[model samples]
Target: MTALAVGCPYPPCTVPTRDLQPIRHSELRMDTHHRGRVLTLRRIAPVVKLTARSWTVTQESSSGGTERLEVILHRSNHGQDILESESMFMVKEPYYTLSDQGDPTLRIDHPSDLVVCTGSLGNDISCPSSGEPGGAVAATAFAAPVTNTAKECKDEGNAALKQRALPRALAKYTNGLQLVAKDTAANGSIACDLHRNRAYVNLLLNRLDEAKADGTASLTGIKDQEHQDLDAKAYFRTGHAAYNLGDFQEAKSLFEEQQRLAPSDRDAIAYLRKTEVRLHEQATGEYDFRKIRAGLSKTAPRADAASFDRNTEVKKSPGRGHGLFATRDMDVGEIVLCEKAFCVVWGHEDEALTVMTYDVRDDMIRGFPAGLCKAIVQKVLNNPSQIEKVMDLYGDYQGIGKHLIMRDSGPVIDTFKVHDIVARNAFGPGPVYSGGPRAEEDVRNASTGLWIRASYLNHSCVSNSKKEYVGDLMVLRAARPIGAGEEITHSYNESGDYDARTAALKTTWGFACTCALCLAEKADGTALRTKRRALELEADAWAEVEHAAKAKRISIVKARCLARSINDTYEDVRYNGLPRTALLRIRKWLTEATTRDLAGC
Candidate 1:
């Protein structure tokens, strides 16, 4: 827990999906006479300042769908358990600013960005120019290739791959692929070629399944003649990787198809024969490819959970407890983090189980299907310690803002805690619908689940990030360019007048609003209270208006209604468009930001 040895000096072969919590280092627990240097880090404004020594940083992409913007210190330690370390704190992209930083020993930028200026290679930092920190020049395997602007990126990627600079190659290939998405050329040939080139790079990186997937992507829109050549190579590379992965049947099919296309590819024929043999062995239970399959590739759109942006980490802020912060420069639309949902329960039912209360026997947990209720409740019933873990989350659900007089049975507590966690941190189970806004009825009808790590992000009315549920994953994309060391924040309430948002935050999640918009609107007062109390106040106001109307006090009724309408126009100004407007805005902003960052515009 004290010191974490940076484990990957040589880089890892595969990038595993990281958990947001502490990474396990039990396997790294070692008793050694030679101890690696310990690099202790300290935090300043938004940068994790290196107080120990001036260390060089590097940017490299891994086939595991992660890009390591910085490296860790390697150490030899005597321990027998996983080394619990804090989230990595550092900022990565837009390192161009460091080009003039004039410190050779100190680096505020990644080495890859200084390749043209810093003509050196190794672990140490170096800079031959003013304000430029340099260590190892990025891989330049092949001399730069001259090609049309559309093909320029892929050609650069090819050179990086020859240099064995897998990460840099990926970035270039990805850049090319992005351009292809926007291109409207004949038969989409350029896009196919990009996929085919990326597939080859992935194959070299040992990402077999991703290579196969990319290979398949290359086959789309193949009416163009240029793609015909790419198609054969794509299939051949995919088959070769699949063969190594023990996916013999798939390998066989791909290899056979490749040979048919090339007609004279002896390598494809040989691989096809080997695949047939492996398939026969598999059919007879002579081999188990599970272990190999597990390491094949990560095609999912997330970095490892333990993986943080070079400048991202856990820090404590007063009032809100622990939250995420940037230690370095991050571009708008950067992926700060991605987490898998710890629990993904949707349409769960609890109709038969209700908590007893005064005036009412119990509150019906309706809208949830009966089958889902049993399944979820059973999961809790089977797990004895579920409540304690669930309680570790923000369980400020003062259910009805009243004391729960229900019996202390474990299942009942499970229901209460689960309800609290869901209310505070859970997002939807649908794509886009998960974290995006929803109608009150649509929310009740949809499924919801919790992603534990993402729960640490605090609320901001004028948030800089977009938190969305994309399929089973919770993604956090930067909405605006974030400076290093700045806090990462997202909106938890709607774009509306302060009072209504405050009430929702206070009544539902049990929190007060202090974000910029809230403070600007002078949102003061504890809006937290019973849900029914909120309804009661609204009802009382309407009742008074109704009474005045009946008594012929038309002026009073009109004044009250007009005041209410005028006070609630903030929402109309922000989101009066169709529901899809929010979705479109998110897409446009994110796409533009990403393109700018990658293309270095």
Candidate 2:
């Protein structure tokens, strides 16, 4: 039999001297000295038993020593190498062995204990009979070391805390503290951050005490300017809580602290001021909230009017109910309801005429009635209470200088009632003195008076009411049977086309018009376009004939036909680029012809 060479690849004292033994079918066992420790082989198994050809061993010791060994084993058949053996072992220090049924098991007797081993060897040696061909043994084994119990608890607690389980996080933090017996930086930092976030959430839910407690917790282990800033923010939140609870004084104090901390912060300053004002009002007993309620009650319009019978029903549009309806059958001249003007502003020019300091020498110009104007002006000046509110609401008049006739630092003019009514009712042809060619010759005047209920009428191209001024009062007569709920409308501008009317409505009233006249006019655009084109052609023909007449070249009969065409085309040519003077001359001629034509009959 060939003598088997059994030697450890590890250093001197690490060699194995034991019989071959198997811990399992494919596993081998070994123990050796590594570094200064007598380390034991726990177990070894070949990943592929038939394929392995060479073996390697590595060892580590308790005293921080390491050893590496490689051994080549071979099998031969008829002087030829059939299979080269392979093995590998990882050995820890303080090696030891156990035996069961002639199979030796290798392991570390004490994993954490200290041990010593030999460092150097001089030569290789043959294996002893008691030693295994592929195994190892160590001199002795040491005892196992102890571990801290609290670390496990801390780890479990931390895992729960990371999942945002607040209760679990607190428990973990407590467990970690119990193990370490003092605050740790990692655990303390996490706890502080978590508490701060929790405090904010609690504040949102209006749990004031809870929020304050959490905020206090957040301050633990936090220091310096950041802590003070956070404290200021917390005080601001506390102020908000106090404010919501109607504790103005407390709120003010907190907000004042916030302002001191952040002087430039607008929100803090505003809250502080507001709370101070409220507290001052409370202290002085100056906040008469009941007076405000009474004033609002007095200003509210009466819902029940005596004029309309409650039992009567008026027809209205399909979806909309009746707004205002006639309670009784009324004559044409009957008054509806008298209402004072809600507000009024004198025309810029009229105000200028009244406040003038200069003397008027021109007889053709009419001066304002000084007595009435003065009384109105004095009323405006003397009524400080009225003027104060008005000035505050609308701001000061920048155009006052432009309209001033006299600079009395006294009261403003108050003659709004008559003038305002007149303005509402006044409607006529275009302004005669527009700054065009005929501006010097044209004289424009607005009808002045105490305009009746007709003044409140709305506008429409197709109107049911006819308005006429009698001395100083405006008279309105229904031209058709106006239904009870129908609005009393008037034509403000007779010359306005559909688009012009719609535009005026939108500008003045802030709504798109759905009036019958607007609907009809919009429907007529296609037909109106054709008619306008024909009118343009007729106007052009008339212009040529008028040119001939101006040169005194056209015959009398031809001139008459052309004059007729001019009258028919008046609407089409009125707004054209014709010089105002020339247009007026042509208008005068047309008037004369029409007058003659009427006289001949």
Candidate 3:
């Protein structure tokens, strides 16, 4: 609910200060203390002038009292302002309280409310800089004679590539291509090398379409009997682009061409084999899942070999956005779909990957692994072709226009949109284990990934389908028999009671679930609800001590009694065949206890 406390302060501002009119007013809510009261924040002050990013202003409140608002703007490296507004409003009347003690802080909660900076003083204000942004830089790079400029750009791009500065490297390579003439045979060698090298860089950056075009041009520019090795390299690069774009058959042909040019090229041979595997998986929805899982410890592709989606199709749902539906009848326990993650972050060894980020405006704290947001952004930047697949996903920042900041080197991405998208769509870092049950701490730091198609499967308390993760692959299976054209659903929050499930869904996904199970639980009498809560708590307590009791071979009657109590709470007609998540473990415990007692007799 406040500005970022961590950062290297900008070199002292020499620019003159002018009156700052509050250009925006973000609506506020304090969920912990407001009891669902939405407050509309209106600025009564005409203007406030300050020399720094942080300023304090006196404002007239709705209650006709003076309120002091302290606004601090933290300028991110991506050229967006993280606005922290702390308002201490005067209270004239008793407001309905959600807490016994009052909360003085007010917050703006959405990313769109935070201003996109042209030059750091929020939007609509520009900071003074020494040079014209991208134009001046580009002009200077091309000022030299065309041939000399081409050579200079090629050398600079190679150096940047070695340093792993991808965007800078891409800019240099592009500059070289602009100056080099492609028509003449005399310049063909230089042009060929430039296109081939640029294609390689594009492949590294995941700009597959650009890479494919450049690779094709590199091959075309080669005169007969000139650069046999270059031809092989060109084919290899183009093959990869096609492979990544899911054109496996074309990729196979390209790789075979590369092999014909250079039989001993190991990289080409390996990728050719991979292409064949992808072709096989594409034809039949089958894979060596065991091999894929075992390969998790080694460095491998972030995407799995194939996306098996033959059983489903995306179609419009009534109230919700597009949802995944079964295209054919599927039996219970049958695999419905298997897809690879678009991006994922998995912690190593004892590393706790989850990082907590404070959203000052929203007064919300969200946590994800440190590089997860950057990973997604970089993935999109590398392959601008896939930008729509990511941007089309549901987010809080929809309808907000361009946030990308143009820079001399390349476009500086605004990660706020990606951050919001990940928060809504990602799954993992818990309930995912490679082997046996892990400690709670290990489970908390597990792995997380975004599966675009999987996100389309909406939430339901008693879902028709269930999802499991293996490496980066998301495997969806029908929990109950699903008919043709049936919309598949999965429980978003399966661990909690009715209230907890509803609250989690509303807080995390921004929707109240009105599924059959949720509705039934809501209409359940108050007495029954109270009894169920008490019984669930008792079962939890028993679970905590069950392992220790089992080591001592203690009587299992309490486990049996707890299981019975849980089962009785769920009505037979309403909850039949639906997963009673609360009762599952208890029944297992009772079964184990009965087996042990019988063995002793």
Candidate 4:
């Protein structure tokens, strides 16, 4: 028999604890003492077991863009239904060793208690069995500890609230929440206050899930009764958000509780009635939510997606080596592909490091929980080509990360490859940015992840596709229609002019722009260059158009003609649209010129 102190390396893995001890399986353990509680274990021969099942995949074009896919997994062959259908899972009755209605020894309490992983291509199925201690972590877990005082953060939030600066208020509340979680500056009341305030702000900002989470936190873990009134606010606002989000049952429960705590609140009464009406409507199927859904779809393009459309494939592209290409006509908002991340790092670290070392970046991958690290390592090792694919990204790993990255450390080569892949392709610690070259600011705030399928997208100033990150999953959606055999591309940056666009792309990704627009701009002769310079001037400098006239020493008349032409048809740039900005500037300049009686006008 052997006992060893070990970090848990199994399911229920989102928890970190220092007290866990791993024991040999052959040595069945007896009960242990913990604050005067007795713990027991039962045999597994009569207990439940899971078997590998069939996997299925479905594909469709995403409303938000990109080819989309949905995968369904099925499990069968248990003799009878284990648990009630209303619970989190439908286990066969024959497999039940416990019951939800009686003893919940091996059962889920309710359907609402269902836990699912929100990140891409992974399951939250890791749970380590250790008689040690444990604590929870969120999807956005980071290595940094909060340093600000809860009171200081709350006071700042109060100031922001006074100014109606909703975003600022949210930031302050979050800072306080982080401080509380890190145990650096918060007491129970401050924690409650932080959660309650953050819930209200989240409601105002229409972040329904975060509002619900904060509201739940505010109500729970309140050891003090002095702040029940604040808790009531959290309940009411959470209910309000639930109602708006169409969770009628949850809204009903939340509103009722709030009304009990604040008996004379009319808003709670109204909400209660509204929730009842909605519940009835839902039971009778009398509500057609399609219209609300349609309206949301119009505005929800900011963050949405899908993938797995076979109309696209990865293949060698001219000058670009490899790229994703469409094999058939695809409509806008169609999802083209879905990919799971290979390795992900939560935040950045600064140390005694050099630019070429990339050690901090490597730590991002190597720092994952032990079980997760093994799973990720095994995944790449299982497919050696995946490592090669990652290595083929942009810059040479040796040229940049050789000093430390390639050291004889275990999995060093694998970590270096993943880091290179993420450095070239990672997106989002925030919502999608249509702009180019993200992740340069404060690496501590950046989240780096690798998506093999998404890496196939090549650069285009006028890309036909865009990507969205749902956790570690990468979904590429079509920005516009595409014909068969067309290569899929996404802008490395938001739309910019020839010089700015090329410079940004070159500096960020080490690529030269040879697109049609670039070639056309290269043909600019002296007169055309003068027109372009005037066209590029800021709105306040509309008078600069006369500089074209000053060149070649011509009259204001010729200058006006050149200005009108330049303004009307600088046809080959990113911001071109109806009612061009240049034309608007020209109109302003023309009005001023006419008032001055310039012959050019």
> Cα lDDT of all candidates, in order?
0.44, 0.36, 0.60, 0.47
lDDT of 3 by residue, 49-102 (tens): 221132223333233333323232221112222232212211111122122124
Candidate 3 least-lDDT 10 residues? 8-17
TM for candidate 1 is 0.32
The best candidate by TM-score is: 3
Who is ahead in lDDT, 1 or 4?
A: 4
User: What TM-score, over all chains together, does every model reach?
Assistant: 0.32, 0.24, 0.69, 0.34
Candidate 3's displacement at residue 60, Å, is: 36
- Residue runs of model 1 more than 4 Å from their true location after superposition: 1-311, 347-390, 397-415, 429-443, 523-601
Sort every candidate by lDDT, greatest first. 3, 4, 1, 2
Q: Could you give me the TM-score of model 4 versus the true structure?
A: 0.34
Candidate 2, run of 10 with poorest lDDT: 118-127
- Candidates' RMSD to native: 25.5, 39.3, 11.9, 21.9
* lDDT of model 2 at position 531: 54
Compared with the true structure, what per-residue lDDT tens digits does model 2 show for residues 71-143?
A: 1121111122211121212232323333222333332221112111111111111112113322233211221
